[model samples]
Target: MVSVEVLNNHPTGGALCAKGRAAPEIVASPRRLTVPLKRTRPRGAADPGWVEVSWDEALTEIANRLGAIRAESGAEAVAFGVTTPSGTPMVDSFEWVERFIRGFGSPNLIYSVEICGWHKDFAHALTFGRGIGFPDYDNADAIILWGHNPARTWLAQATRIADARRRGAKVVVIDPKPNGSGQQADLWLRIRPGADGALAMGAIRHLIATGSFDADFVDAWTNGSLLVDRATGRFLRADALWPDGAADVFVRLDASGSPVPCDTRYTQQSGGRLRGVLSVRARDGRMISAATAFELLVERAAPYTPARVAELTWLPIADIEAFNALLATRPRLAYHSWTGVGQHTNATAIERTIASLYALTGACDRPGGNRWPVPPPTRALNDYNILPPEQQAKALGIAELPLGPPAKGWITARDFSRAVLEGEPYRVRALVAFGTNFVVSQGHSERNKAALNALEFQVHIDMFMNPTAESADFVLPASTPWERDALKIGFEITQAAVETVQFRPRMVEPVGEVKADYEIAAALALKLGMHELFFGGDIEAGWNYQLAPLGVGVEDLRGHPEGRRFPQAFRDEKYAVTREDGTAAGFATPTRRVEIYS
Candidate 1:
């Protein structure tokens, strides 16, 4: 069908162009005025009377009202919420948004931690002092992927993973589903979900039962050598002995009485002596002799045999042993896990279990192993990192905003919801959400909506009117990525090839009468007389000032969309040790050699 019409600009500022080939019918204001206005509110016992207004009025009310609430009821009375960065293309902007909310000081900075990457972070941190990010694409010999489906969720990551395989990395995928990435893997170990820990443990047993365990590495570089005191329950040490408590499993206070950082052992790149002692005690709390790394590995892994893992996980004994056999080879391995393992009841413990595999194999902080990603400078503005201290405090407050202490102990996101709904400690009153998609994101949608509806103040920001936006008292239209400006620092992984950095430019106008989140923040600060507290001056001017010191101006970024890259940057090189008297240093553990035993 064809329609032809010459028309003036519409009242909404949209051009009144006639429809061509396949198009929707367009009616003018006359049709709008004749129809009864669609009912603004649904029939409900818990509706926050809806009101229509101009953007100025909306912003003014939100800024003033929220500030007033904080002044009168204390910061605890308000909640600042932002959920997962699930569907948005503005992955980089989230870091900025998090800083903005924390700067606001509501203390309820709820994020997509338990839902997204907590398990991975915790597990990797235990072994490598950081979460496992992928190794460089060309360097991997064998890649074992468990509990991650990057294609559907992280397309960019999937591309890199595929690139690695094309470069000769042997890809082994362990997952229940025939996911897009898994289907392309050379080896697919399809076990039931939630049984990964059992599978990994079974591998450990096989490695131990067979002679393929890396005894030299385990003896020199791990806590595996330390023996466990079953009766008194403390790690056996060469010197002092202490009764075991819940937190006393690993490291303890040194001679200076300061607690020896638990993961320091993983960071040691060479042979060293440990200042703190591992200890075991008798029933009467008397000292017993210390054991070596061999003692710890044997004792801790005793309960997780092939048959026991089969029983716990419902996997066959044979499959478990095969996995165990592969692990026994002591090949350099990189491990990663995500929400699938973290969203359960025993998330933290599960993470610790996975972490042990890395430490056992001496793969932490090595080349061709998983390490944190380091972003190149060409991708970023070399500006002085400056954001107000109050703002910093506000962002961290998000984790603490529920008032008093968290009623229920922390575990997973589901547990957090249970604590809120049950009001074990107190009620969850006011909620100000940014980029939160309660419908699809939450594990339980019906219950999440119920909890959201019960809030006193509900605000949302988005480019479109999604279910979450419809439930809000105020809806602030946020700009898409192309219309905004900011800096993004990705995690550092490995020093692979040339250090490359890139930037994307805003390609179009903001969707509607929306604003960049930072500008929105500035406007609110101006309205609330908090300009000095947040941006120091006008937000744009503040941004200009920040840019000037970095040897570039606003014009440079706006004109050059493609970012600069740094050449010949040192990334993965030998870690250095320094001496007190102008000489290279040695390893700093108790046994000068890689301590096979402490």
Candidate 2:
């Protein structure tokens, strides 16, 4: 391998970090797993008694055993495992791995997300009906970094934050410790761990009490004023209150303190009451007591007063107000959060609360805020529909945590280990894992190892023989990102970035008989008679399918390594986009609005 350098004038700032600079060394490292290997001994044996094997010998055995396990104990017996792409070369193969598992009819795919991107990517969907989008740093007037250290984590954002600061944007850092860019922050609060939810509630309370919130946005783009049944804690149905009202509609108290029909698409006039509980006579001859969602939110925040938050977060009232001041005054606010916020006990609550606070600012999907950067319409490859509903229902942990990862075909390490060790939810007899080092990435490492040892069969694919791979019956060599030809649809932070498409050719040859992760999955699928699902075992055909919407294929991308852009103007306030249902399409939540009470 030779030296590495960033492509000149690339959309990603044309820069490289120390890690990126070490790509050549990583590709040529002595520790690299260069060939397929088989364990001659049992999993718990002192030595695996490793022996080299051909791709056919390794993959045919894996496919045959996986099918046998499924035939004997159902598809749920064989689970898939994939490494998080954020810190690994698995980015190119993540969707492909998902496609393989779903096509194979297995509902479980174990990947550690609770400690990583779960909160930012999945938990926020509870309120917003979508994950947090790219922060529009270019036009932001106030930039809030809540437990996010872009300088150390995301160089592209660090560059954007630096440029934004240079352009006179105010900066606020809400973290317990001082990070790199915090040195220049206009306000830095050393918040107590797990108390970010408190700070968010305090901010929302301050905005509400001072009448500084975006009332129009709140009424039109959030379920804040939708009435909730006091007894059932659900949205009060209009039909329950009046004989003429429709069951599909919800009730909201208008400006005159009268109940009005509220639809899922937030198209109501901006006059809903934000506070106070009320009682109304129902058709059932019962007097129902109900409160607006905003009223409940306000009530929830009542205890999180400035003084209370100060005690809980160990920050002075002055500092707390400063934090609220930014959210109140900065109409062009942009914010980001990361692992530090997700590593706490109330991680999901913190994410939801912060999302609610941001909703009050009416900055989501708008200019100078967190805008949903539209991406290249790559036809999605992960078709879970192929996995029948009955099969999907058997996914481990789905019944217990219906809204969590299990619903999305991914399981946590804890539940996965339990399924193997105790078989409470059903035994996971076999695993086809790609690049995940769960033995170290997860908590209770020893228990995880023991569970791995108990598996009837395990196949691991990685560039190096990591701890998790060492426990597997077969360890197949996988090529690094540098040695693979990957098609990039969109970098996704801005309109320009989202419009760009690049196909990167291999930068280095594999050190030995290493195959790309997706290639390995495709080859296995061919053996498993899933040729149609994996594009007839043709990687280029799959890439072509993904590029169809762009009117470009692999051949086109191959000629444009520098990338080609499908230029289009950026659209702001996308939540208010008109829909076919003749309603102002709001957020993607069930109410088509930001959900605070969820």
Candidate 3:
């Protein structure tokens, strides 16, 4: 392409960061890999005879090698790899890549998610079957940016926060190193690194101590009133109270301080005033001491006072108190976290504590707070269940660390190294990586190098020849996003953002024999005899399928390069709304609530 310019909605459509502004350069770079390369020398050699080959030859070789490995070692021997999409053109084909992996029957996907987007994309689901949500910054009254500096990361969000600040919204930024945005905050908490959990707990303590937590929300939408057996640290089940009661039924205390049998049957408010401690009679005629979920949480958070947190975080007591005071205000409390709070060993626990702390505000699905705005309908892309259970069971780390990344078919670099180097769980002989530069992006560069070299066969698909691709037996060229006509579902920050859809028209042609990620995956799938699964390599057909729910088609999107707005709008405070079935719209959690105690 000769040049590129901002497409509609134009300047206000969405602000651009430096990375976005450099798109033209990224597409027309002098270093663009235009041809397929085949390594004809031994692994770890200084100069692998780089030979250019036809796409047919490259695809045939990759298909044969990957197929043979899968046939011999049950598909678990070949691990597929992907990089984070947020920072690259990989976003356009993220779903298609996963589909290809599943269609190929490999349960392991070597993705750099453990320290990038995992906390915001998966860990939060443990508490409520969902992850971090889009913050309603436009309608927000107060914004608590915990470990998230949108100015440096999210330009559109930064613009919204600036507008909120101009309208006098209270802005409190928590980061070790305050940036320009944090500097502009009404209050910036210079917290010590890795102490976000303590600060979150301190905030929770303050909310509860000042009587600022949403009691009605807590009673109705959380497990705060559920009784927990103090001895076993488990929910006191109904089977403990009666011989015939189901184990899934838990005990709850009613308004009259009476023990009541509870299940996930009803998600509405329970007018219970249970707190502190009490003893309940069991089926075995024993008195078991129990505490309400609320009391247990309160007890857990009791020790993390502002003073205590000041020592743990190195922030002044007054700063913690000031944050407490702001959180106690009547305005909606909107908060967010990023990788900063998710890179450490105790990141999960820290994130969970922050999640629990945020639950106390009752700001979810509300105006001026964090929310999951319902988007215009689209067909779901992920269908990992297509892989048989036996294949799924071969995920590298699932057998040992059941709750880790492997539980969801994701592979950490450490596990990938182990599978390739040590073959602890199973050996990974071949690797097909798309846009993933494990050398620069993942931890332990030396270990990753060894693992990459140890692979019997490796195929890399990327625009530039990075260090990670040095070990590849074949290096296939990939097209830039500018050369791909990809449909963007939504901006996903607010309801308005979700209502708008865009079809980013391809601006340029591939430099040489390069192909888009989807094209490569589709061709590879066909070569592997998975023609039906890949829609016969027809990408637009898949795009049309995804657009069916919105009464739109790929041609319609192609006609509107600026964007097209859907008719339906997002609804707010969803849990408070009674449905036609006479039941409230609850959360996606097992308990159908925010699940504070889960």
Candidate 4:
């Protein structure tokens, strides 16, 4: 594989405008001999051991084993898994897998959203009913770098940061360590790790105390003033929740929607250096009150002030305070990128708090500060509805199912290991994985392998032999993104174009026994005697069905790789505040109002 470092400097602007320029011309070279984790499955090596077998043998064994397990233990025993590839073209293949599992009533389709990006999604949904895509990098005045460091982790987004910097946007970085991007920041607030929510709450408090908050925006566009009983719902006084009311401490919203803060908290003493207030909002579009909102406030930031943060983070607080002051004075955009900040227990809360900075400053969904651009392959469900069908199904399951609320699919990677080991409610005896790297994706090294050992069977699909594929009971080889027809889209919201859809051709034949993901899926469906539901026995027919409603067909997309750019953004009707029943639509919160206390 090409190194990410080498791909980092690929041309941009008109240079990158060339189609297929960004992708490598070659998929991979023919591989030499490689070793496996274990030679066979009987020794308890976590995941059935690697054994060389024909594709037919592997497929037959996988189907029989999974079928037997499902027959013995019900659909809950089967789990489907996949990983995030940089340019994954087989999303629909995974979708097909999810559909099959759902069709069989399984609750084990796992994803990385909750583990890495769901906080941003939930936060954006609370604010605008949809998670904003990449930020508008070119149109910012001030940029706040929370726990996120894009320089090393996401080189694609780092280019935008460099461009934003060239245009005189003041860059401020807040992190536990002095990351590469911190060197370029006007100010670096090196506060303690896991203290981001504290810094954000402090900033909000400062904004309110200093009268810099966007009250008009809060009152008009949010649920800032809803009342609720402290004990019954997800709301309450900051003091009641935490004994150290005004001291340096953090507050949080519990599962029950109540505002609570930790005890034994003290403010970092920094000689009155950095402190302030800002308005915050919940999902129902309510703004938090300064009084009740104190739970979400940061009192210690006032004390850590500048000097304390400098001492704690080792980045001079005066410089940090200067950056903070500049951001407060000017328009600011906050970008949340996945890096070190996204791999921790506090990731979701930290991301949400960072997003609150944009909302507090009235920069959310705007031109400069974290603007959310519309997506490609547009569909209608009124404005601000981007919950794809599968996600919607998952959310509905959380709401209506007798099973406990939905597990955090995106955030709970470790739990997968745990569930496989413990099998509390039911055993996750079988795992069907595609392009997933267990060692790379999970942390605790020993536990991951052990969990794999505990599984009754492990089926992996991939183009090349990977750590995961080498450890599987069955390895179903998969095709490359280039060696398959695909509909491609990007999450980047940028300057040049709007909602471009492209098609990629199968550049080469399959290597060895490899097959396109779609083909493998259809074949599996056929083997399972459910061929009609999978693709109606024709790949092109399925593709045509997916494209017909868009007024485009397979022939139109064939032979053209650059694809077409749809002209107009779909203009949907405005969303209503109240339902037709004359009653309010309940917020996801227990009280269903914009939660000020929470």
Q: Backbone collision count in every prediction?
A: 36, 0, 0, 35
**Which of the two candidates, 1 or 3, achieves a greater lDDT against the reference?**
3
TM-score versus the correct structure, for each prediction: 0.73, 0.96, 0.95, 0.74
What candidate 2 gets wrong by more than 4 Å, as runs, is 264-268, 579-581
Estimate the overall C-alpha local distance difference test score of candidate 1: 0.51
Name the best candidate (by lDDT): 2
lDDT of 4 by residue, 173-263 (tens): 7766776788778776776776566556556555656667665444333334322333354433344333456433334333344444422
The Cα error of candidate 4 at residue 506, in Å, is: 1.6
* Per-residue lDDT of candidate 3, residues 49-123 (tens digit): 899999999999899988988889889899989988876889899888998998898889988778776776677
User: Could you list the CA RMSD of all candidates, in the order they appear?
Assistant: 9.5, 1.8, 2.0, 10.0
Arrange candidates by lDDT, descending. 2, 3, 4, 1
Could you give the candidate ranking by TM-score, starting with the highest?
2, 3, 4, 1
| Regions of candidate 3 where Cα sits further than 4 Å from its true position | 8-12, 242-248
* Candidate 4 global TM-score: 0.74
lDDT of 4 at 491: 30
Q: Which model, 2 or 3, shows the larger lDDT?
A: 2
As for candidate 3, its clashing pairs are: none
Supply the global lDDT for candidate 3. 0.83
Pitting candidate 2 against candidate 4, the one with the higher lDDT is 2
Could you tell me which 10 consecutive residues in candidate 2 have the lowest summed lDDT? 265-274
